[model samples]
Target: MKRFVGFVKKEFYHIFRDRRSLFILFGMPIVQVMLFGFAITNEINNVDIAILDHSKDASTKEIIEKISASKYFSVKDYLDNENEIETAFKKGKIKAVLNFEKDFSKKLQTENQATIQILTDATDPNTANTISNYTGAILQNYQELINKDIVTPYQINTQTQLFYNKELKSVFMFVPGVMTIILMLVSAMMTSISITREKELGTMEILLVSPLKPLQVIIGKVVPYIFLSVINAIIIILLSIFIFKMPIAGNYFLLAAETILFIINALSLGILISTVSASQQTAMMISLMGLMLPVILLSGFIFPITSMPLPLQVISNIIPAKWFIIILKGIMLKGVGLAYLWKETLILIGMTLFFIAISVKKYKTRLE
Candidate 1:
């Protein structure tokens, strides 16, 4: 027990003595959270739009006023013709062009409908789609407001309630994802690199040749990482809760248990990497390129899985971080329990076992 305590103390000394590692371990989580929370966003706002009103009538003028009044769109240019619209788009001054057909008011009064063309630069599909939707919504609202005086025979009123994130704040979604990624990075990548460093320095062989069991050595190496990862998780959660005002709807104990499970899984993966890697550099590169990218891109962290291609969707199934993020979201956002997240929990357990088995096999083979 005294030896174990000394080992832990040595680990702390190593962590504290290395300013770079300490900065990365403590600072990276907060930096990632802030970057993802503020810098990265999917929600569209203040999209620039150009208008080409051929009618210049009361209805067209009113429609333009409605669009300009909307928070989603800012009318950047009043286009004189279709040529000007194209020129404006080419100049990158506007994302969309709204063209009202000739005699729009007259047509609306007589035919009960008027054609308004929404020409958008599809270079960025997401922005284009959002701009189009915003335009359509403004038009619909204008029509509804104008028709409110005359009651229709049938009216369908739709009320949409966006659960979990009422404001559809991207930060709410990103906080849990950032937490998962940071934990994975610090626990798995750092552990792998640190363990491989011992092997590179010829210390691992000495420890293996000693009375210490392979499991003991591995656990000792991982113990510090687990402790650091827990601290990081706590810091991130506290920052999200207090600074960002993010909610923790589920049981705090359950959340901690799930976080520990994810950390264990990540740590096991790190151990597996350390067993396979010949050097610290190799382990670090493998963890960053092989693990981090997939965790960030394919884990449904920033992009929705439904939006990804079929092949990419299939590929994401293998990423343990993906399952961990889903579990976190279920518990944190939806306030779900084990019953709801059992599948993801099972997947994480399976992945951890797979990694541990592989590491054990590899280590034993190396010994022989």
Candidate 2:
């Protein structure tokens, strides 16, 4: 017990002594959380819209007033003709253009409806869709106001329930994803490179020649990382709970168990990387380039896997972070138990076993 405590103390000393590792371990989570929370928002606000009201009538004026009043859009310019619409859009200042027909009020009074064209820049499809929906809602509100005296024969109203995150804040979604990423990076990448550093520095030979078995040596190196990673995970969770107000609806014990499983999986992957890499630099590069990119891009962290290219979608299936993120979301956000996330949990377990098997095989070959 004393020896283990001494080993842990040494690990802490090594971590604290290196300013870069300490920064990455502590600073990265806060930086990523703040960046994702503020910069990567799904909410559409103050989208610049151009108005092309050819009508010059009361109805068009009212519709324009209603659109501008809403917080979703700001009227940036007025287009006199069709030629101006293209120019305004090309200038990149406007995201959408609302065009009222030439005789909007006259047509509406005579025919009961007038056509309004909503031209949107679909470069960013999500933003374009949101802008279109906002415009549609404004038009519907205007129609409802004008027809206040008339009673509808049939009315349909939708009350959408956004479960888990009632406010639909993107932070709620990003929190678990970011946590998974940070934990994976610290547990896998750093541990892998640290282990390989011993080999590169020729210290691994000295340890191997000593009384310690290969398993004990490997375990000693990894155990400290597991402890540190758990502490880091706790810090991240506390930050999310207190600072972000992220809810933890599921059992704390279950969450802890799942987190341990993920940590084990990541650490095993680190061992596999350490076995394969010839140097600390190689391990670091592979962990960052190979593991981090897939975790960020393909793990449904920043981009939805459902919307990815078919091949990339298939590739995402193998990433451990992808499954971990899903499991974390299910437990943390949906308040689901093991029964709900068992498949993903099992997959993670299987991956951990596979990685451990490969590392053991590689280690045996090195021994022989």
Per-residue lDDT of model 1, residues 1-368, tens digit only: 99999999999999999896886788767755643454345665667778889999998898888888876777888988867865565444466788888888887777677788887754344455556676777777777787877644212121222235555566676788889899898788877886688888888777667786666767777788888889989999999999998888777998999998899899989999988898998798778866886788778677544345456668889988888877776677667678767888899989988987887787667666
How accurate locally, in lDDT, is each candidate? 0.75, 0.75
Model 1 weakest lDDT span, ten residues long: 153-162
lDDT of 2 at 266: 93
lDDT at position 288, candidate 1: 86
Clashing pairs in 1: none
TM-score of 1: 0.60
The per-prediction CA RMSD against the true structure, in angstroms, equals 15.5, 15.4
Give a tens-digit lDDT track for model 2, residues 107-205. 767667678888765433455567767777877777878877765411212122223454557777688889999988888986788668878788877
What lDDT is reached at residue 110 by model 2?
A: 67
**Cα lDDT of model 2 overall?**
0.75
